[model samples]
Every structure is written in structure tokens, then in C-alpha cells.
Target: MTMTTDTRPRTAVQLQTNGMGDLVWHAEYFRCIAEQSQGGQVTVIAAPTTMARDLIGHEPWLREVIDFDRRPRNGRRGRHSGLDGLMRMGAELAPKRLDRMVMFSDHPGRAVIVCWRAGIRTKLGYGATWLQRLLLTKAPRIAMYDGPPVTGTYLDATAFAIAQGFCSAPLVPHINVRPDALARMRERLAAWSQPGFALSIGSSEPFKQWGAENFAELAARLARTGAGVLLVGGPSETALAQAITAGIASELRPQVLSLTDAPVADTVAAMSLMRACIGNDTGATNIAAAVGTPAWVLMGARPPLMHDPSRMKMLEGASLADISPAAVEAQVLAGLA
Candidate 1:
């Protein structure tokens, strides 16, 4: 549906309760809102996960980041707890008296309720559900096709908001790393004056992860070229990182450094410093791309077209194992060059 730009709101809230990759995808959406509002206040209502905090907490465009703790509490955990949590969240938000709301989540029923109860006059989101179509003041229909980029699906909501005159700017996904973080990363890696590459080996699911052996071989190949390798991931993947680190030959081990469980800001800063990044189709890879670092993403299960296309070289197969180490090494070498 076409919408005329009318009723510029003074304050707007965005609802995004997904993972880090999704947060990176919505960075453009958030920027569009800020631009259209002409610096009007914007807030993000996100989940309480560490990834959410890391992705949205430091955004300069957002005025606040509210942690919408949806985990079942007070014996309220059940199949119906989602609705219960929504009502409670709405009650909590009603006091804010927001002027507008934009939702990026697929589950819009609860968000629609929240906007209504919060007394937000203008609501915008994807009309994927019955409640969404009935409750949202302006919701653009999203059709899922086989080959469309997932980033396109995300950007469509921004386009809708812009078309409606809620915001007036093009979508640009951005990440702002503090100078101190960048300085610290440089200080830590100063010992290795040569250019470096980031190796991200973790994914939200095991199916999406390329085998550790493959990563080990790739790291060995990169190390042979005298490029420092930074193994990146969360604490949960420490074991995997160690295994990959151990797999590298002793002569090349000095060039491979494991940076497991680093802060998101530091990780992003480190990625920015790298010549290029290679990893599974994971949030860290997305973060790397957002920071202007070229990434070679290994894809499994999902199609390559589902992700952002710019500054990325995707290697897809039926499984991560199907992507051989030699193919990844060639791409890595080309990316580094």
C-alpha cells in the first residue's frame, strides 16, 4: 500500500527481538528513521540477550534501548506466555506515550498490541499476520520469494516507512566503533606489524558451521602467507577455537591468535583492522561486513542470496563440509589480495 508522508512524530520506538545478525540488518532501518525524523528521538525495544545489547546499546541514533525480557517469569512460562508477556510489555510501555512505532520482527501481533496500548498514533511494520493487518496503521505486505535477498526483505520495511513520509532517506547499515576500542585492538595486535585476517568459526546452529578441520586448514594456508589470523567467537565456542588453534602446525601457531569471548565492540574494531574476514554465515561475519571488511562467508542449509550481497564472497554447498578447504583458501587469498 502507498502511504503519503504525513504526521511527523516527535518520538518513535522500534521493536526488534532477533539475533545480532538481524540487529545489523535493521541498522539501516534505524538510520532511515533518524534521518526522516530530522533527529527526532528514536528508541529500540529489544530483547535482553547479550547480542542485542552489544548491537543496539551504543547506537548514536537511538535515544534508549529497553530490554524487553520475554523469558517466562513468575510462573508465567508456557505456550501462551508470549501473549501474556506482550500484554505486560504493553502495560509497561503505555507510560512512555510514544508517538510512533516501527516493528522489524516477524511476530507483529504482540507489537501491534504494545503500540495500541502505548497510545502510539502511527504504527508501521510488515503485514504478515491477521493482527498486524488489522492493528497497524501502515503495514506493507511482504512476499517471500526463493531468491530475494533477506537484506531486501529487511530493507522493504524501511522503504515502507520512507514512502509513508515517516522518514525521508535511503537505507544505510552502519556501525560506529568507539575510538578507544579501535586503539586498544591496535595496541594488542601491534606485535604483528604485518596485515591480518579474521577467522570467525561460530554460527547460531551447528548446521551452518563449517567443520573445525576445514577452518584449521584454511588458517594454516593463510598463516603460510605470513598474514596474522585472529580467531573470533563467543565463549561458547572457546573449545572450537582451541581445537582449531591446536590443529595449526607449530611453525605457524605463532601467527594464529584466539580472541574468543571478546566484547562485541572490540571484536568489531578488530574486524575493521583486518584485511579481510572468512567464516561461517554468522553474526560475526555480518558485523565484519558492516565494519567495511570484506568477508568470505561459508554457507550451508540456507541459500547465499538470503544475506547481504555487498563486500561478501559466498561459498555454498549442501553442507559446510562440502566446501573444501582449498576452495576457501583460494577465496581467502583473493580477498586478502
Candidate 2:
């Protein structure tokens, strides 16, 4: 896509999510907007759990990342939920003087109103709801988004950006593994003989998990090949990581490393160091794909989601349990070869 020489305008993207995969997709869109706008950095308002700042803070084109804590936790109102919170957020944002604001999805409905309250004139979004359409100064026609949740918003956002002259073409989703992150992981893995393969084992839902037995078997197989298996996930997956490691043969257990404690950036760095990543369709898998690692996502319970074909490959089956370790091992080994 040819670069535009139009005057760069102050822009902000609003996405409400706690998921890291969603955050990565949105960050790619942010970079696209920045590149097309003559290298103008764009601000992002995202959910805190997404760690938008920590993940892409190193990017020169990222103006800032504002944490949007509107998701209800334990049935209680979030810090930025309800009428008072919205006003507070709007007041907080008013100082930025954003020329344009982009909102993804119709949920919360507060983002558009907040932008309006913050006096952001040029607003862009899907405008699925009547109120959202009324508030959005520029938006695509109302339509159902039938694509995968993780990548759909990014596609929609890029399409909207192009339509509004914010960008030229759709930018492929990518993650630039931070140098510091890489160094940190390198130091952490210095003891291991091989960077080997990574297993992204954590899933937001129970149905998405490929089960401990499957991952353990895959880890054992990889270890047999003299490959160190890195189990990547959040703290919640520690027990599962332990179980998978335990299930491995006693002699091969040391080859399996648990990286559930590593932060998002470090996890991405770890994936960068790996030969390939085989795991559930989760945020960690998305990170691996974005970092240009060959990610074999186990998509057994659902259809293949949108992903960069060059970096992500789907291994589909009737169910998560049905996707055998043997089949996955064969593909991963072949890919490495």
C-alpha cells in the first residue's frame, strides 16, 4: 500500500477485552493506522488484563495505551463501568484532545458516548446498535461479524480505517519481539540445551483445552527428539503445566520447561526462540504466530479462525480430545524438518 501524505490527526482506538489474543490483533491494527498516517502514533484504550502497554510499548508509533477497566469482575462493577465511571473516564480522556476515536464492537456502548463526552469529533466504528450508529460520525454499514472474535475486530477496524482514509491497505497482524524480552528469555533458557518447541496449553474456556494427557504425550515425543518442550501459559495453568511435565517419562522430564510464570512479552520472546509452537487456540498461540513462529493451533472444537497463514497452521478435529498427540507430533516434526 502506498503511503499517504495527508496531515496526521490525533487518533485513539478503543477495545474492551481482557484477552491477550484480542490485544495483539488490535495492536497490529494500531501499527497499520500509524504507518498509513505518515508515521503518526495512535493511542489505545484497552482492558488492563490485555497488557497493551507492556506488549507493544516498545513500538515507536504507539502514542499511549490507556487501560479500559470496564469488564465486570465477580459480578461487581469495574473501575470504569456504569454512569459515574464513564463520566470519570471521559473527563480523564478529554485532556488528550483526540481528533478521531475508533470503537470496536457494540458492547459496553459507553465507548462512543465517552468519546462524545470527551469531545472527539471524528468517530469511527461498526455502529451495530442504533445508539452507536447515532454517535459514530463515520462507520461502516451495520452487519453481523461472523468471523473469529480474536481477529474479526482487527479486520473490521482496518477496513473502517481504509474506508475513512486513515490507512491504505489491511496490514497483516505482527508482533515485534522486544530485544529486552528476548534477552530476558535467553538468559532464562541459558541452562537448556535447545530452544526446541513451545506448547501453549492455557485456554480461556474448558472446551478449548487440548487436555494435559495430550500435551504430555506431545512433550515426551518432542523430548525424545532431543527437543526441549516449553509449556507457555499464565499462572492459572501452573498446575496443568506440572501435570504435563509429570506425565512425561522420568528421564525426559528435565527437557520440559514450564514458562507459565513469564509475562506476555517474555512469553512472546520465548516463542521467538522456539522452533515451533503446538498448543490450544489461546492468547499464547496468537502471540507465537504474531512473533513469526510457526504456531500449530489445535482447533478441534470449532472451525479454523482467521490467522496469518505464513505463521499459523490449524490442526482441526471433531473435538479437542479427538486431536491426537501423534498427528500433532508428526506435523510439528515435519515443519521443523
Candidate 3:
């Protein structure tokens, strides 16, 4: 392992490189270390895919969210891959003079190497492989464990932190939307009399998406209860949003609002106002659940996205198409009640 003679601060730094949902899923663990244990903020070195800056930039527990170009993927070499990128990343991190680095990733070797090169005195991570064990400064003795990458891995990390006397408390998932964004969402929803429910209509893949027809049926049923149905997604899902709105009964069409074009922050704010969210397995659903809104995730290709029954409920089927809108609606109604 590499070493540096420069004196480093005691502040702990976390290196994470996952998507938005994964970031949100592990929020509590981050808080446990930064707030509960350190009684101060921790800096986060996050990947672009995590959107850490946009999602949790305002989190009080974080001192900063630094952008980290992740390793290569899809047969193309990334800017931060191999020896050259590793050296560059190390140089960049050296300025922080970090003493401790915690890595939460499936590929722990690269992160461990980078921290070593940066001269971080202590590097903590799960030694899932031989390379990780050889490189990591400290790691929990994890028994044979196979579970969801985001939730299960974090749970193990939390347990390790507790056993090591790093943090005493176990935190729960909590998301904070910008006050301005929340106000905007509140102002927009005020125009309607009915309470709101959100339908997250976006998915990373076609097979993961619950079709427009299914959402339309669910929206119409929820609308009959006099609740406003907000169709939430990104710009790419605008057509899908429109299709779902069109599928609704003509009389209740006014109850459905399209929010596909809304900014991510605004959509997150809107989620807080919802009675509940029925979404496909997507980042939006995770965001909704993190914000304390009950989210029913329609699991198709992916089963058991996370392990927070208090906020997230998984509805799995052989395929996304197999899950009926009626069954989803029933779950949502029950959750709301």
C-alpha cells in the first residue's frame, strides 16, 4: 500500500459510486457516522451517477459532495480508470489531507487503492474479495452474506461501525427537499382541491416499466376517491405521461397532472405532498420513500429493491406486466389508510 508523510485531519471521508437510489438507500448510515458519531459533517466523494450534489447537497451531515469520475464501463475506458486515472484521483484527494476514508462499493479494491495512494491513514471497507482484504486498512469480518447490494451492504456496514464504536445509533432513511422546491410544489398543488398521490412512470429499461395502460387504470381508480394523481417522470417519459393521462376516464382526466418536465428537485418536493406513490422500480420511487411517503414499487425484472417496509413496499410479479393495476391500487389504498 502507498503512504504519505503529510499530516491529515481527523475528519472522516466517504467514497461512494452508485446511482441516486443507492445514495438515498444508504443515507441513514452516512448520517450515523457523520452526525451520531462524529458530531460533525463528513465529506462525500460521489460519482456523477449518484447525483449526490443535487440530491443531498443541503444535507447538514455532509461537509461537501465532491465529484468522482467512476471506473470504466460498457467496454469504454473512463477518464478515471486504470493507473493514470488512479494517480490523478489520488492527487486530487491529497489536497483534502484526509485521515480516514470509508468505501461503500462492490468493487472495493479500486477505492482502497485510491485511498492508499491519497495517503489516507485509515481505509475502511468490506473485504469481499482477497484483493480488498490485502488493501483495506480495516474491515469487518463479514460471514457469507448474499443480499441486495444497496440495503444489505449498508446494513453490514452499520453493524460494523457499531461494533467498532464508530457510531452508537442506527439511523433511518430520511430525504430533505429544498425549501424553495417544496414551496413551489406546495403552491402548484394548492390549485387543486383534492389531496395528491403520485404515479412514478419512469424506468431505466423497458422491461422494468409498468405500461401506460396499467398506470392509467391505477390513476383512474385513485382519482375516483377524489385524490389528485400526479404523473412523475423525466423529460424522456413525457410521452408515457401523456399516454397515461389520455387513458384515464374523460371525466377524471382533470384529476391527473403531468410532471414529467418538472425539475428533479421539484419532483422530489412533490413527492412529499403525495398521499402515497405507486411507481415502477426506479429512482423516483426510492426518493419518494426516503421522503417519508409510502411508496409501492412494482418489481418486474428486479425483485426486492430495498429493505424498509416502513416506507417502501415491494409488489413483485413474474414480470412488470403481470402485476395488475388493481392489485397495486389495493396496496396503495391500504398503505394510505
Candidate 4:
């Protein structure tokens, strides 16, 4: 991670978000600017994933979060209005007079068009998307992967960006376990937490859910092993939590911590206290990894490369969605035991 200083230090913004993990990975490309850049500013703008901001906005180093839902990137199909959004971004960025811009996109189809509109001279990003590659001053090709703990690819990508000379900062994962996230998690768990707990199994996407009955069975087994089972999710998951709770044997009910009513911020924080979390492939898994909480994430047929592999509590599991309750429970035990 070495670079010749392009003095006249400029404002750096990473524009793109494929997911929470993607946002985390690319945002880190400018971590030094957040910590060491005396005058550089870091802005993360994306089309907004459901809870992506929870990870970035929480960080003090990041200055602004721009999310536009109605206007999806449309420059690719030849519709020019999407460039209008980029123009807006350009106007917003114009005042600062950007010295160096690195768009952490994997060949952003329409975003590169916007970057051009914004007038960034030294654009650095993955050279993907056919029409857009010409826009990059330094756009490298990307390799594909399938594994757990998504942060790895992101880390690799950033290192590539630096090695290629787009950026002049050292690469570090740079994800600090959010202090407020930890406190909120602990406060929610204070009374209900037991010796051990298997985490809530839910995702914002319907396809990501492992059956609630299976989740309940895992909880029952963890309870038998002297661990309390916690069900963590947003309101959408209450029924699943209830079903998991009802299905578990009455004796283990006391050990079951249900906090679907708890605010999402708290749910994310609460994950840190769990002995180990188990869940389907989703944002919660990334959140769990960010907090250093041991977790067994069921990729559920999705490629493993989609999540961070290093932070995983357990990487051994079936790739299928209907991973047996026993299979997940075993991984949780392996992580905890």
C-alpha cells in the first residue's frame, strides 16, 4: 500500500453499494483519509440498501450519506436522465473542487457516467460494464468468488486499487466495532441473556429465511447444551420468533430471549453479546461480523463469497437453504464449544 502523494489533497467519495458488506469494503478504501487526511473528506453515496447506512453513517469519519430511492441508475440503457442524478451529485461535489476521486464500483453501469458528469479527472475503480470502462483513468478488471465473510473480496479489491496506484493510502479493514452498537446490544441483553444463546434467524429478504421450525429446533438443542437461545429481528420477524418460541419445548422457554420489538439498532448491538449467532445469508450476518460476534451464517444456496469469511464464527454448513437444524446447531456448537 504505497502511493506518490498527489498533493493538493482532494475530497474523496466512494459511490456504490451492492450491499452492506460492499459498502463496508469500499468505504474502507479511504479509511486513512478519514483518520490521516488533514483536509480530505470521505463521502459514501449509494442507491441505498435497506440498512447500509447503519454501518457507514455511524462512523464519524464519513461526512455525508446520500441515498436516492426513486431514481435508480438508468444511464446504461441509453436513458440519460440518470445522468441528471449524477449531475446533481456533480453540483454538490463541484464546490469542493475534487482533487482525486475513486469510485469503488465493480464497473458501475450508470455511476461512471455520473462520475464523468461530476468532472473527476483521476477516476479509479473496477473496469467493469462495457460502455463505462472508457471513463476510468485507472479501472482494473475483477475476479469472481463464492465464499463466506464478504469483507475479504472487498479488502482484496481495495488493495488492488492501491497497488494499481489509484489511491495512496494503506489498506486496513478499518471496521471498528461500533461503541454505540455494542452498548445498545448489551443493554437489551442484560436481563434476558443466559449462559449461551443462538441468534435470531431472519433476513429482510423472504428467500433468505431458513425455516422457523428448524431455527426453533436449533434453539432447543442449544438450550439442552446449557445455552439460552435468543431470537433477534425486526417486526417482520416477530411471527417467526413466536413460531420458534412456541415450537421449542416449554422447559427451554425461559432461556429464549425474544426481542423482535427491540429497535433494529439494539438488535444489531445485541448480537455482540451472544455466545455465537446463527442466521440465514443476510445483512444481520454482516452486522454480526462487524461486531466481532461469532456467527454461523447459512449461505443458503447463495455463493459464500457474498459474505465476509474471516469474521465468520463457523464457515462449515450446507450451501442449500434448507440446511438441517442439526447441521446449523452443530456449527454453532463448534463455534461456541
Candidate with maximal TM-score: 2
Which regions of candidate 2 are displaced past 4 Å? 1-7, 36-39, 72-75, 128-130, 139-142, 147-151
Better of 2 and 4 by lDDT: 2
lDDT of 1 by residue, 1-337 (tens): 5443545564555555456776776776676676555244477776555365566566667777776666533455533247766777777777766677777655666677777667777777666667667777754565433244546545565555565565576444557776777899989999973688898888877677787888999988888988899999988889999999889999999999989867887888899999888898778888898888888888754656434567777887677777888888886676666
How good is model 3 by TM-score?
A: 0.87
- What lDDT does model 3 reach? 0.76
Local distance difference test scores for all models: 0.73, 0.80, 0.76, 0.62
- Off by more than 4 A, model 4: 1-8, 32-41, 50-52, 68-81, 128-133, 138-159, 165-174, 204-207, 262-264, 300-303, 306-310, 313-322
Highest lDDT among the candidates is held by which one?
Answer: 2
Number of colliding residue pairs in each model: 1, 0, 0, 16
Model 3: which ten-residue window has the lowest total lDDT?
A: 4-13
Residue-level lDDT of model 4, residues 209-289, one tens digit each, is 677777888888888877777787768788888988999889888888887886555666676676677777666766666
lDDT (0-100) at residue 315 of candidate 4?
Answer: 40
Report the lDDT tens digits of candidate 3 across residue range 232-336: 999989999989989988999888999988877888899988888888878899899889898889886464754577888888878778889888888778767
**1 or 3, which is superior by TM-score?**
3
In model 4, the number of clashes is: 16
